[model samples]
Target: MTATASSPAIIRGATLQPRPWANGLGISHNIAQHGDGACGFGWMIATAELSGDAAFSHYPGIDRVFTIIEGQGATLTLEGSGPLRCRPFVPAGFPGDQATHCTMDGIPGRAFNLMLDRAGWRGSVTAQSLAAGHRMSLRATAIHCLAGQLAIGEDVLEAGDTMLPADNVTVAAQGAAAMALVVEVAARVG
Candidate 1:
Protein backbone atom coordinates (compact mmCIF):
# COMPACT_ATOMS: atom_id res chain seq x y z
CA MET A 1 0.00 0.00 0.00
CA THR A 2 1.21 3.50 -0.78
CA ALA A 3 1.77 5.70 2.22
CA THR A 4 -0.50 8.68 2.73
CA ALA A 5 1.26 11.95 3.49
CA SER A 6 0.79 13.19 7.05
CA SER A 7 2.32 15.49 9.61
CA PRO A 8 5.20 13.96 11.59
CA ALA A 9 4.75 12.78 15.16
CA ILE A 10 6.99 14.51 17.68
CA ILE A 11 8.26 12.78 20.85
CA ARG A 12 9.87 14.80 23.60
CA GLY A 13 12.99 13.42 25.27
CA ALA A 14 12.17 14.79 28.72
CA THR A 15 8.78 13.07 28.90
CA LEU A 16 10.01 9.55 28.33
CA GLN A 17 11.67 6.73 30.29
CA PRO A 18 13.39 3.44 29.57
CA ARG A 19 11.22 0.37 29.69
CA PRO A 20 12.58 -3.12 30.26
CA TRP A 21 13.41 -5.12 27.16
CA ALA A 22 12.06 -8.59 26.57
CA ASN A 23 15.44 -10.02 27.55
CA GLY A 24 15.48 -8.03 30.80
CA LEU A 25 19.11 -7.02 30.32
CA GLY A 26 18.40 -3.64 28.77
CA ILE A 27 15.85 -0.87 28.69
CA SER A 28 14.23 0.93 25.78
CA HIS A 29 12.06 3.94 25.14
CA ASN A 30 9.63 3.50 22.30
CA ILE A 31 9.77 6.43 19.94
CA ALA A 32 6.84 5.39 17.72
CA GLN A 33 5.16 2.50 15.98
CA HIS A 34 2.77 2.52 13.00
CA GLY A 35 0.34 -0.18 11.99
CA ASP A 36 -2.86 -1.71 13.22
CA GLY A 37 -4.12 -5.22 13.80
CA ALA A 38 -5.07 -7.56 16.57
CA CYS A 39 -1.71 -9.31 16.69
CA GLY A 40 1.05 -7.22 15.11
CA PHE A 41 2.40 -3.90 13.84
CA GLY A 42 4.04 -2.97 10.55
CA TRP A 43 6.92 -0.98 11.98
CA MET A 44 8.39 0.31 15.25
CA ILE A 45 11.16 2.67 16.37
CA ALA A 46 12.83 2.74 19.76
CA THR A 47 15.85 3.90 21.72
CA ALA A 48 17.57 1.33 23.91
CA GLU A 49 20.39 1.27 26.43
CA LEU A 50 22.25 -1.98 26.97
CA SER A 51 23.69 -2.46 30.41
CA GLY A 52 25.25 -5.87 29.86
CA ASP A 53 25.71 -8.68 27.39
CA ALA A 54 22.62 -10.77 26.66
CA ALA A 55 20.69 -12.71 24.07
CA PHE A 56 18.30 -10.74 21.86
CA SER A 57 14.71 -11.76 21.47
CA HIS A 58 13.87 -13.47 18.20
CA TYR A 59 10.99 -12.37 16.00
CA PRO A 60 10.12 -14.48 13.05
CA GLY A 61 9.36 -12.72 9.75
CA ILE A 62 10.75 -9.38 10.86
CA ASP A 63 13.72 -7.19 10.04
CA ARG A 64 15.73 -5.09 12.48
CA VAL A 65 18.07 -2.18 11.94
CA PHE A 66 20.06 -0.48 14.69
CA THR A 67 22.37 2.48 15.19
CA ILE A 68 24.50 3.50 18.13
CA ILE A 69 23.47 6.75 19.78
CA GLU A 70 25.86 6.99 22.74
CA GLY A 71 28.96 5.31 24.22
CA GLN A 72 31.27 2.65 22.74
CA GLY A 73 28.71 0.50 20.90
CA ALA A 74 28.34 -3.32 20.83
CA THR A 75 28.78 -6.45 18.71
CA LEU A 76 25.95 -8.57 17.40
CA THR A 77 26.44 -12.29 16.82
CA LEU A 78 23.83 -13.68 14.52
CA GLU A 79 22.99 -17.32 15.14
CA GLY A 80 24.30 -18.53 11.80
CA SER A 81 26.22 -15.53 10.53
CA GLY A 82 29.48 -13.88 11.47
CA PRO A 83 29.63 -11.15 14.09
CA LEU A 84 28.68 -7.58 13.17
CA ARG A 85 30.26 -4.48 14.63
CA CYS A 86 27.82 -1.82 15.69
CA ARG A 87 29.58 1.51 15.81
CA PRO A 88 28.20 4.96 16.55
CA PHE A 89 25.68 6.36 14.05
CA VAL A 90 26.27 3.63 11.46
CA PRO A 91 23.04 1.77 10.86
CA ALA A 92 23.05 -2.04 10.66
CA GLY A 93 20.31 -4.33 9.38
CA PHE A 94 19.66 -7.98 10.16
CA PRO A 95 16.93 -10.54 10.28
CA GLY A 96 14.85 -10.47 13.43
CA ASP A 97 14.30 -14.23 13.49
CA GLN A 98 17.97 -14.93 13.99
CA ALA A 99 19.18 -15.95 17.42
CA THR A 100 21.14 -12.80 18.03
CA HIS A 101 23.58 -12.32 20.90
CA CYS A 102 24.96 -9.05 22.14
CA THR A 103 28.37 -8.21 23.63
CA MET A 104 29.26 -4.84 25.01
CA ASP A 105 32.46 -3.63 23.38
CA GLY A 106 33.72 -1.18 25.96
CA ILE A 107 31.20 1.10 27.64
CA PRO A 108 27.47 0.71 27.78
CA GLY A 109 25.75 2.61 24.98
CA ARG A 110 22.35 3.71 23.76
CA ALA A 111 21.07 2.70 20.33
CA PHE A 112 18.23 3.48 17.99
CA ASN A 113 16.36 0.46 16.67
CA LEU A 114 13.88 0.07 13.81
CA MET A 115 11.86 -3.09 13.40
CA LEU A 116 9.69 -3.89 10.38
CA ASP A 117 7.30 -6.77 10.05
CA ARG A 118 8.49 -8.36 6.82
CA ALA A 119 5.11 -9.87 6.00
CA GLY A 120 3.69 -6.40 5.44
CA TRP A 121 6.46 -3.80 5.19
CA ARG A 122 10.19 -3.12 4.78
CA GLY A 123 12.25 -0.02 5.56
CA SER A 124 15.61 1.63 6.16
CA VAL A 125 17.14 4.12 8.58
CA THR A 126 20.08 6.50 8.25
CA ALA A 127 21.70 9.31 10.22
CA GLN A 128 22.28 12.77 8.77
CA SER A 129 23.23 16.26 9.88
CA LEU A 130 21.66 19.33 8.32
CA ALA A 131 23.04 22.82 8.72
CA ALA A 132 21.59 26.26 8.09
CA GLY A 133 20.99 27.01 4.40
CA HIS A 134 21.24 23.29 3.58
CA ARG A 135 18.22 22.21 1.61
CA MET A 136 17.01 18.63 1.96
CA SER A 137 14.24 16.65 0.37
CA LEU A 138 11.98 14.97 2.87
CA ARG A 139 11.90 11.73 0.95
CA ALA A 140 11.81 9.46 3.93
CA THR A 141 8.58 8.48 5.64
CA ALA A 142 9.85 9.62 9.05
CA ILE A 143 12.66 11.72 10.52
CA HIS A 144 13.82 11.60 14.14
CA CYS A 145 15.77 14.44 15.66
CA LEU A 146 18.92 13.20 17.38
CA ALA A 147 20.55 16.50 18.36
CA GLY A 148 20.22 20.26 18.00
CA GLN A 149 17.36 22.16 16.45
CA LEU A 150 15.75 21.96 13.00
CA ALA A 151 12.94 23.98 11.45
CA ILE A 152 10.73 22.92 8.61
CA GLY A 153 9.17 26.22 7.66
CA GLU A 154 7.59 27.24 10.98
CA ASP A 155 7.68 23.75 12.50
CA VAL A 156 10.66 23.18 14.75
CA LEU A 157 12.03 19.80 15.95
CA GLU A 158 14.42 19.23 18.82
CA ALA A 159 16.17 16.10 20.04
CA GLY A 160 14.02 12.98 20.60
CA ASP A 161 11.25 14.16 18.28
CA THR A 162 10.00 12.21 15.25
CA MET A 163 8.10 13.53 12.24
CA LEU A 164 6.60 12.36 8.99
CA PRO A 165 7.36 14.74 6.17
CA ALA A 166 5.41 15.21 2.98
CA ASP A 167 6.94 13.51 -0.01
CA ASN A 168 9.35 15.76 -1.96
CA VAL A 169 9.05 18.67 0.44
CA THR A 170 12.31 20.61 0.30
CA VAL A 171 13.32 22.45 3.42
CA ALA A 172 16.43 24.13 4.76
CA ALA A 173 17.92 23.62 8.18
CA GLN A 174 17.50 26.55 10.57
CA GLY A 175 20.59 25.97 12.68
CA ALA A 176 23.92 24.17 12.86
CA ALA A 177 24.21 20.78 14.63
CA ALA A 178 20.81 19.61 13.38
CA MET A 179 21.19 15.85 13.16
CA ALA A 180 18.49 13.25 12.55
CA LEU A 181 17.73 9.67 11.65
CA VAL A 182 15.58 9.16 8.56
CA VAL A 183 13.23 6.17 8.32
CA GLU A 184 11.77 5.14 4.98
CA VAL A 185 9.04 2.55 4.87
CA ALA A 186 7.43 0.68 1.98
CA ALA A 187 5.10 -2.22 1.37
CA ARG A 188 6.64 -5.64 1.05
CA VAL A 189 6.97 -7.10 -2.43
CA GLY A 190 6.37 -10.64 -3.54
Candidate 2:
Protein backbone atom coordinates (compact mmCIF):
# COMPACT_ATOMS: atom_id res chain seq x y z
CA MET A 1 0.00 0.00 0.00
CA THR A 2 3.00 2.29 0.07
CA ALA A 3 3.80 4.63 -2.83
CA THR A 4 7.18 4.17 -4.44
CA ALA A 5 9.42 6.39 -6.54
CA SER A 6 8.67 4.40 -9.69
CA SER A 7 4.92 5.06 -9.52
CA PRO A 8 2.91 8.07 -10.62
CA ALA A 9 1.92 10.25 -7.67
CA ILE A 10 -1.07 12.32 -8.76
CA ILE A 11 -1.65 13.01 -12.40
CA ARG A 12 -3.26 16.42 -12.64
CA GLY A 13 -4.70 17.63 -15.89
CA ALA A 14 -4.02 21.15 -17.03
CA THR A 15 -6.39 23.75 -15.63
CA LEU A 16 -8.55 26.11 -17.68
CA GLN A 17 -8.41 29.19 -15.43
CA PRO A 18 -5.55 31.34 -14.19
CA ARG A 19 -4.37 32.49 -10.75
CA PRO A 20 -4.15 36.08 -9.54
CA TRP A 21 -1.05 38.07 -10.43
CA ALA A 22 -0.03 41.42 -11.87
CA ASN A 23 -0.85 42.17 -15.47
CA GLY A 24 1.12 39.94 -17.90
CA LEU A 25 1.84 37.69 -14.94
CA GLY A 26 -0.57 34.92 -15.76
CA ILE A 27 -0.02 31.56 -14.02
CA SER A 28 -1.70 28.22 -13.26
CA HIS A 29 -1.29 26.27 -10.04
CA ASN A 30 -1.44 22.42 -9.93
CA ILE A 31 -1.33 22.18 -6.20
CA ALA A 32 -2.64 19.54 -3.78
CA GLN A 33 -4.73 21.36 -1.19
CA HIS A 34 -5.67 18.94 1.56
CA GLY A 35 -3.38 19.63 4.48
CA ASP A 36 -1.99 22.96 5.66
CA GLY A 37 -2.57 25.94 3.37
CA ALA A 38 -4.06 23.85 0.61
CA CYS A 39 -1.54 21.03 1.06
CA GLY A 40 -0.95 17.94 3.13
CA PHE A 41 2.09 19.17 5.01
CA GLY A 42 2.38 22.12 2.67
CA TRP A 43 1.50 23.04 -0.91
CA MET A 44 3.17 21.38 -3.87
CA ILE A 45 2.51 22.73 -7.35
CA ALA A 46 3.71 23.85 -10.74
CA THR A 47 3.24 27.29 -12.32
CA ALA A 48 2.99 28.27 -15.93
CA GLU A 49 3.69 31.57 -17.69
CA LEU A 50 5.62 32.91 -14.69
CA SER A 51 7.27 36.30 -14.86
CA GLY A 52 10.70 35.45 -16.28
CA ASP A 53 12.00 38.93 -15.73
CA ALA A 54 12.75 39.06 -12.04
CA ALA A 55 9.04 39.35 -11.36
CA PHE A 56 9.26 39.12 -7.58
CA SER A 57 6.19 39.20 -5.36
CA HIS A 58 4.88 38.01 -1.99
CA TYR A 59 2.45 35.41 -0.68
CA PRO A 60 0.56 36.38 2.45
CA GLY A 61 0.59 32.94 4.13
CA ILE A 62 3.06 30.59 2.43
CA ASP A 63 6.83 30.42 2.39
CA ARG A 64 7.99 29.32 -1.05
CA VAL A 65 10.86 27.91 -3.05
CA PHE A 66 10.83 27.78 -6.85
CA THR A 67 12.55 25.64 -9.45
CA ILE A 68 13.01 26.82 -13.00
CA ILE A 69 11.37 23.87 -14.73
CA GLU A 70 11.91 25.17 -18.22
CA GLY A 71 13.06 28.37 -19.84
CA GLN A 72 16.18 29.80 -21.48
CA GLY A 73 17.34 32.01 -18.59
CA ALA A 74 16.04 33.94 -15.58
CA THR A 75 17.24 35.63 -12.41
CA LEU A 76 15.86 36.23 -8.91
CA THR A 77 16.75 39.21 -6.73
CA LEU A 78 15.99 38.32 -3.13
CA GLU A 79 15.56 40.61 -0.16
CA GLY A 80 18.58 39.37 1.81
CA SER A 81 20.52 37.17 -0.60
CA GLY A 82 22.45 37.38 -3.84
CA PRO A 83 20.69 37.44 -7.20
CA LEU A 84 19.60 33.94 -8.27
CA ARG A 85 19.86 33.21 -11.95
CA CYS A 86 17.00 30.83 -12.62
CA ARG A 87 18.72 27.79 -14.02
CA PRO A 88 16.71 24.82 -15.13
CA PHE A 89 16.62 22.18 -12.36
CA VAL A 90 17.99 24.50 -9.71
CA PRO A 91 15.89 24.94 -6.55
CA ALA A 92 16.09 28.18 -4.62
CA GLY A 93 14.48 28.94 -1.26
CA PHE A 94 13.14 32.28 -0.11
CA PRO A 95 10.94 33.88 2.48
CA GLY A 96 7.23 33.86 1.73
CA ASP A 97 6.93 37.60 1.99
CA GLN A 98 10.44 38.47 0.87
CA ALA A 99 10.31 40.98 -1.96
CA THR A 100 11.75 39.69 -5.24
CA HIS A 101 11.56 39.80 -9.04
CA CYS A 102 12.67 37.73 -12.05
CA THR A 103 13.88 38.27 -15.62
CA MET A 104 14.43 35.68 -18.30
CA ASP A 105 16.15 35.45 -21.64
CA GLY A 106 13.78 33.03 -23.30
CA ILE A 107 10.22 31.75 -23.41
CA PRO A 108 8.51 30.63 -20.22
CA GLY A 109 7.27 27.17 -19.36
CA ARG A 110 5.95 25.27 -16.36
CA ALA A 111 7.93 26.20 -13.26
CA PHE A 112 7.56 23.90 -10.27
CA ASN A 113 6.62 25.38 -6.89
CA LEU A 114 6.77 24.04 -3.28
CA MET A 115 5.37 26.13 -0.46
CA LEU A 116 5.39 25.59 3.30
CA ASP A 117 3.25 27.36 5.84
CA ARG A 118 5.13 30.03 7.75
CA ALA A 119 3.70 28.89 11.07
CA GLY A 120 3.79 25.10 10.82
CA TRP A 121 5.87 22.77 8.63
CA ARG A 122 9.28 22.86 6.99
CA GLY A 123 10.17 21.49 3.53
CA SER A 124 12.50 21.61 0.55
CA VAL A 125 12.26 20.61 -3.14
CA THR A 126 14.38 19.96 -6.23
CA ALA A 127 14.02 18.98 -9.89
CA GLN A 128 16.47 16.65 -11.61
CA SER A 129 16.76 14.92 -14.96
CA LEU A 130 17.76 11.26 -14.80
CA ALA A 131 18.89 9.18 -17.72
CA ALA A 132 17.75 5.60 -17.83
CA GLY A 133 19.38 3.85 -14.87
CA HIS A 134 20.74 7.11 -13.51
CA ARG A 135 20.31 7.99 -9.82
CA MET A 136 20.28 10.99 -7.53
CA SER A 137 22.51 11.32 -4.49
CA LEU A 138 20.14 13.39 -2.42
CA ARG A 139 17.82 11.64 0.03
CA ALA A 140 14.69 13.00 1.58
CA THR A 141 11.38 12.11 3.17
CA ALA A 142 9.45 12.15 -0.11
CA ILE A 143 9.77 12.50 -3.87
CA HIS A 144 7.51 12.77 -6.91
CA CYS A 145 7.73 12.86 -10.63
CA LEU A 146 6.39 16.20 -11.74
CA ALA A 147 7.02 15.85 -15.45
CA GLY A 148 8.45 13.75 -18.23
CA GLN A 149 8.49 9.97 -17.87
CA LEU A 150 10.03 7.83 -15.12
CA ALA A 151 10.27 4.27 -13.85
CA ILE A 152 11.26 2.95 -10.47
CA GLY A 153 11.31 -0.80 -9.89
CA GLU A 154 8.26 -2.32 -11.62
CA ASP A 155 6.15 0.86 -11.60
CA VAL A 156 6.13 3.57 -14.25
CA LEU A 157 5.33 7.16 -13.53
CA GLU A 158 4.36 9.21 -16.58
CA ALA A 159 4.00 12.66 -15.06
CA GLY A 160 2.77 12.74 -11.46
CA ASP A 161 4.30 9.85 -9.55
CA THR A 162 4.70 10.43 -5.81
CA MET A 163 6.55 8.21 -3.37
CA LEU A 164 7.30 8.11 0.32
CA PRO A 165 10.84 7.58 1.54
CA ALA A 166 12.17 4.34 2.96
CA ASP A 167 14.42 5.08 5.88
CA ASN A 168 16.01 8.00 4.02
CA VAL A 169 17.07 5.68 1.22
CA THR A 170 18.15 7.23 -2.06
CA VAL A 171 15.68 7.00 -4.95
CA ALA A 172 16.64 6.86 -8.59
CA ALA A 173 15.02 7.03 -12.03
CA GLN A 174 15.62 4.59 -14.86
CA GLY A 175 14.47 6.01 -18.18
CA ALA A 176 15.02 8.72 -20.73
CA ALA A 177 13.37 12.09 -20.17
CA ALA A 178 13.03 11.20 -16.53
CA MET A 179 12.55 14.08 -14.14
CA ALA A 180 11.59 13.93 -10.49
CA LEU A 181 10.62 16.36 -7.76
CA VAL A 182 11.95 15.76 -4.26
CA VAL A 183 10.36 17.12 -1.12
CA GLU A 184 11.13 16.65 2.55
CA VAL A 185 8.56 17.66 5.11
CA ALA A 186 8.54 17.68 8.94
CA ALA A 187 5.67 19.05 10.95
CA ARG A 188 6.49 21.94 13.25
CA VAL A 189 4.16 22.12 16.20
CA GLY A 190 3.96 25.34 18.15
Among the numbered candidates, top lDDT falls to 1
Q: What is the C-alpha lDDT profile of model 2 across 5-103, one tens digit per residue?
A: 444334334432467553345665554432655324455444556654546546656778777766765777877888877677778777767677776
lDDT, model 2, position 190: 68
Cα lDDT tens digits, model 1, 72-139, are: 88899998889999988899999988999988888887888888988788889988878765868778
lDDT per model vs. reference: 0.78, 0.61
Backbone clashes (count) for model 1: 1
Off by over 4 Å in 2: 1-9, 13-18, 21-24, 37-41, 51-54, 79-82, 134-142, 146-148, 152-155, 160-177
| TM-score for each predicted model, relative to the true structure | 0.87, 0.69
Best by TM-score: 1
Per-prediction CA RMSD (Å): 2.7, 4.6
Q: Tell me the lDDT of candidate 1.
A: 0.78
